[model samples]
Target chain A: MAEVNRQILLVSRPQGAASTDNFKLVETPLAPLADGEVRVRNHYLSLDPYMRGRMNDTKSYAAPQPLNEVMIGGTAGEVVESKNAAFKAGDKVVGMFGWQEFGTSDGKGLQKVDDTHVPLSAYLGPVGMPGATGWYGLNRIIAPKAGETVVVSAASGAVGSVVGQLAKLAGARAVGIAGGAEKCRYVVETLGFDACVDYKAGNLYQDLKAATPTGVDGCFENVGGDGLDATLARMNAFGRIAVCGYIAGYDGVPVPLKHPSLILTQRLLVQGFIITEHLDVWPVALKELGTLVAQKKLHYRESIAHGLENAPEAFLGMLKGRNFGKQLVKLI
Target chain B: MAEVNRQILLVSRPQGAASTDNFKLVETPLAPLADGEVRVRNHYLSLDPYMRGRMNDTKSYAAPQPLNEVMIGGTAGEVVESKNAAFKAGDKVVGMFGWQEFGTSDGKGLQKVDDTHVPLSAYLGPVGMPGATGWYGLNRIIAPKAGETVVVSAASGAVGSVVGQLAKLAGARAVGIAGGAEKCRYVVETLGFDACVDYKAGNLYQDLKAATPTGVDGCFENVGGDGLDATLARMNAFGRIAVCGYIAGYDGVPVPLKHPSLILTQRLLVQGFIITEHLDVWPVALKELGTLVAQKKLHYRESIAHGLENAPEAFLGMLKGRNFGKQLVKLI
Candidate 1:
């Protein structure tokens, strides 16, 4: 292993939209493994939309990501050195290792996983935080009944892709709202959703209405602009909405719901959730996700950025919908 | 008791704001009571804000109020004549009798209420639909715990008065937002709310922020406008908002929530409900409401209009915040 650790830090807060200038990359000496500490060599750094919210100094589900710190993130890696009794060398693990090539933990929050069947990087997407996020939003919040219709925005992204597939698995009709025709095809053909609406087609409301013939009974909202507005218009009475993210409003603009009266008219139950606040569900979510991956029932794609230096651009691209699937930085 | 029934009919739909012109007075020949039917002489006609929503031909929780028919409403009256064994003459009951001097029911929806301890009109306010509405939204949706702050809009209105008192009874801090100083005084002094903010004071956000120092944990929203928007700004993390009505938007204006991001940032559960959809809670809700009114633990106020021909203006006044507490028309 190397003595030098390459890491990225949040240097400044974004004014409107995030850019690479807001982040800085530096090389520092890796900390030695102290007593009861384990050294992890991070392989993949997960770039999610929630990070954009943390970049602003606003009150949110989480505190603002402090400046001049290793950017907060999820990582999947192998234990290079261990001083804790619970962990051993060469153990594949996952934790909030942040945006760094090396991390030191006391094995407290680190979760050891079996990478024999599921790949190590897969834990950062399908069987990890994003996976658990999708699971909790769909299963715990929406709770789709059989034959019900579930519509998910950002349907090709990590969390939403899983929501659509899981909705189908629950015997509910799964419809997706994606940005492009290419992503829409992948959502329906690869992800096995019942139908897909390409929001970029400039016919969101009409297309969404046509896609959901019966009406949307449950919604997994990832983006909160026209896609969500259109979905709200087509919602059935007593529909449930799990607001996992508002990627459209992360640019520091106050995004308003156009039809606030619809909530009462439709009798909708709209709930917003942050996955980090619900750690109690990980064991249940991970077990099912891992089993599905091993059985080839769950599939996830990733857009890989090669170096730690490119993490800032990768993050900005993810926020602007330029990156497809789970955006990950390869720090190895 | 009478050969003809004097009634008000919805002759036209409102274009923007509901006016007296939409209603017409007509005396119709009463259909003689058939077998298994009961004739009710309506003593009190309950005028609520929800009637404004039904005046428009829009998709809502309940269907539109059909034109050229008696305006839909709740009524408390005496059973004048009965052909059903389940009901008898001189019995005090409550049901959806619409806006008229008399009503005939098949005894299916009629509720036999004991007005010995609770007054007949109190059944329309406290031990009735509005009472049950406050009960369900508070006990079922918000579910405020001890020491939590519960804020309600339209605080001096029928449903809001009960919610504030109920919040205090549940050991929570009750904060209210009313339109003027008089209603604000009644909310804190009569209804026993912890604090009442007069939205007309020109400092809604600042005043509400002062009233809820610890931040609002639960909100019972009746009118959607600046009051709700101000409450959203002061909401604590994991706050619960039970939306019962949007009187501000009933004028056919689209009301947009200024900060929809707050729902996600605060991790709130904002649900809109119609009490009619939840019949399961009526028994439990009415039991508590009835006992409270009977024991004089629950206090209510009403502004009664004299005749059924004036029901349209009474309704328009209630929608504009002219009437205090329950807006009931004395049809006796």
Candidate 2:
């Protein structure tokens, strides 16, 4: 076992866009586990867009990640040692273990994960929070009927990829909005989406309109700003928009929704959701996601940043749409 | 009976703000009623903000009102000449009779209104579409719990007044937003809202934050733009917003929602609804509204224009927030 634990802490609140300067790497002497505590050696630290909001000292769905503290995030790891009855050594588990090489928990929020049929990293992407988020937004909020056109922004990302795949599985036409041609191609050819609009290609509105000839019936919005506006413009009457994330505006600057009056005229249902608040659907979501992953039906991609020291740069890159898919840091 | 019917026709679509120039008053020969048709001498023509949208040559929840035709509107009238079995002479009925003194219908889409305890014009305000709209939004969309703060915009207007009253009846604290001090007073003192924030008072965000110390749990949004932004700023996590109308943007100009990231961080459910699409709730809504109006539990105010010739000006006035409460043109 390592004598020291390396952790990344938020040194300062981001004014607009977060950079590596906001984070600090610290190596602290490992302390012995207390009673009912399990020490986990984190294999992968998940870096998500929602983490950016946590860096701000403001009221949000979750409490702001404390300054000069370990930045909160999801981690998939193995139990290296345990003083808790719920967990045994070598047990694979996932929890909000944060940006660290080691995490000690009281076994309350930790969930045991099996990597027999699915890879361990799959729990951090397709069969985890991202998957459940997509499932809940697409199923509960959007609820697109068969033959409807469903548009998903950040199409190559963890959540959006699952959303498009699920929409296609439900017999709806899935149209994805991705940053580059390569990602767009993967979204269409690999993920089996009906169409993938490269937002970087310009003509966003016209491209979206061309993709959704029947008008958009549902939208899984990960990117807000222009992508959301384009989708709103093409939304059919009684359309639904499941706003999973607003990554475009997470950097302190406000993103305004253009032509909000269209919401009234179109009679749209736009719901914003946090997956953590909806744990009831997680069981159903994870089961389906696991089955898809096991059967090699669900496709997922990850851009890994080796070593815990690289996490800050990887997170910043992910925010800038630099990462291709799920951004993760390899700690072990 | 009058040989000629005086009607307001939409001569041209307004570029920005609707004015009297867009409407042309015309006298047309009354066509003879056919089988099952009933001729109604409209007593009151309801002038609503939605009429402004119908005047534009664009798609909306309902079809655009045809150019050079009787301007589309709801009317409460007496069936002076009924050729159908469902109605009789002097029978008070309500239907989409448009901006005219007399209307001929096949008795379809027309309902006989009782003025025993509730006034006939009450069917155009409290016991009508506006009332139902408020009820549907408050009960279904916002669904505020007891002790929760529910903020309502355009609080003295047709739909908003009813929404605040309903929220109070549901045991929720109702904070209202209105144009002027007088309207704000009516929203609180008359309509029984807990507090009223006058948007025209110029301290919208601060006033709203002060009024809703516990933070807004639900919002019945009638006026959008700045009013929406203010309410949104004070919203609690998991807040619900029932967007019934954006009267603030009814003049063809776009109303953008500021700080849309709040929707994601707060996990708000912002749904826009055209009351017409929710006819399933009308019977339930009307029954409750009728009982409330009959018992004087629900209070309402109406700004009445004298004749059908003045309908255009009244509508334009209503759009500009010149009239308080339900705007109606007394055609009789």
Candidate 3:
């Protein structure tokens, strides 16, 4: 059978809001797989805020997407051709690949996804990078003791939703902060959070005060702008804040810290993390999160776009807080 | 001979700059010692920036000083009279006493100051609370690896100066941020800092960049404001920041985080500390810091105001970055 290949290349670095002009879609014939390589036909692509940092030319934890290079993203795909003995054709796997319909990999950094246990999309959501991020931060950094108040921002989003639910499982009072009433209700009723604050409401500070009257002991900081300022104001002494992502400022804008004195006066701990940097810690977190999901103690939702061409729109929507949950683009 | 008892009280909270009006000079006859309390006379009053935080009514890790209460401070004094078995009349002791010419204290929180071994003023500087605060934060929180870049703000002040010297002893690249050329020179030559930036040199960002070209691996943050903004921009990946004090914003004024994205992008660890909260760790720190000071491994400078009446001015000067080194009130 003849092979087909589709590729998406980064055309330019985004100055502010990423536009379609930054990417170029192209079609080419698939090159034959070399020894020790596996060919994958992509099915689902993860759309995450971290990609914004990669779109810049500056040095970061991950290498910047070089000019005219393919935009990097985590992809779940089925092996269509294999020269590597580790993965045969038809094996489902997850790996870091550019925005493309098909990718050729050396099986390095690739994890075999057992599609028989969960839907393929779950590999990019609850049982994937975002969930592992929340788990590791909660366990290793915050170490939430039972009965403590735990606050998580971007509550309806992938990582934070998982974080709130996990805190609940650990017997902590889990509070969530989201952009709208619907997401707030979902976080409280669906994800088992004790309370949810609607940050988009004009009374964000008041709402937060009402939600966490005792002050939060631990915080999963996913959206870090005004919401971070509000959280900083209400944190208890010795509060631990896991600085996972600053989604609010990813567009290259500097957001001011409110009551910056909280960092000093309250004696709070704010630690930053990128899950990949702690990949060595992946097993313990993956095992726990997988068990939680398998036991139905955790839940996930996805707002998936149809194809690779729609990734830019999906990513832009995710940035604007328009996506309902883990934003993914279905490539196949 | 008639025994005299005098006290200093907080008359009014200062709005921007504290003045003599913020204090009330009062004279009261010494109250007869009650059970479980001892009567002692104030000798040397320890003036520090942390006292400014207590003067405010806002909530903090430590309780705020109530209006019209005695101005709180740490002091090294001779126990002229002791009702408790732990002290004697001629014994040199240290306690958390407010700014006063003569005051009484219970034996609690008082440590005998071996004045014969070290100068009495050392109880408030290198071998006392200030030194212990710097030592614990630097050694425990930052834990600079040998040859790592360690940057400290208020580099010639009580805490930061000690932190820099300790970092040097730990074999790290120690850089300091101070307000003047003289202080910066002292930080480099006297305190053994690899480099020192003058925050008052008109171009702080450029100066800081020049001083820490490798980027800061650890930051001992004391004077947080514009200097903090500059420091945040220069942190390397996984940098640790010990927030000892925000002397720059201790007065009721808001200071914003300049670029919060640094926390996320660099995976910085920022933690606040109160020296008293970790009193359990104080002895260990004191032992180490005392050795450093005694052995000339650490050097300290003091700006001693001659009388108790000059404390308000000295404190005001400290807040304005005018006082050199550790500001103290010397009493006969």
Best by lDDT: 1
- Model 2 chain A: weakest 10-residue lDDT segment is A246-255
Summed over model 3, clashes come to 0
Docking class of 3: high
lDDT of each residue in A1-332, candidate 1, tens digit only: 79999889999998998889999988999767799999999999999999999999988878899999999999999999999989999999999989999999989889998999998888988898889999999999999999999999988899988899899999999999998988999998899999999988999999999999999999999999888889999999999999999988998788888898899999999999998899899899999998998898987889899989889999888887788898999988
lDDT tens digits, residue span A299-323, model 3: 8889989978888888888988899
TM-score of chain B of each: 0.99, 0.98, 0.96
Q: Assess the local accuracy of residue B331 in candidate 2 as a C-alpha lDDT between 0 and 100.
A: 79
TM-score list, all predictions: 0.98, 0.98, 0.97
Off by over 4 Å in 2: none
> Which residue pairs collide, candidate 3?
none
lDDT tens string, model 2, B161-241? Answer: 999999999999999988899998888888899999998889999999999999999999888999899899988988999
Error of model 1, residue B307, in angstroms: 1.1
User: Against the unseen true structure, what C-alpha lDDT does each candidate score?
Assistant: 0.92, 0.91, 0.85
Number of the top DockQ candidate: 1
- Could you give me the TM-score of model 1 versus the true structure? 0.98
Positional deviation of A296 in candidate 1, in angstroms? 1.3
Q: Which model, 1 or 3, shows the larger DockQ?
A: 1
**Model 3 residue B267 distance off true place after TM-score fit, in angstroms:** 0.6
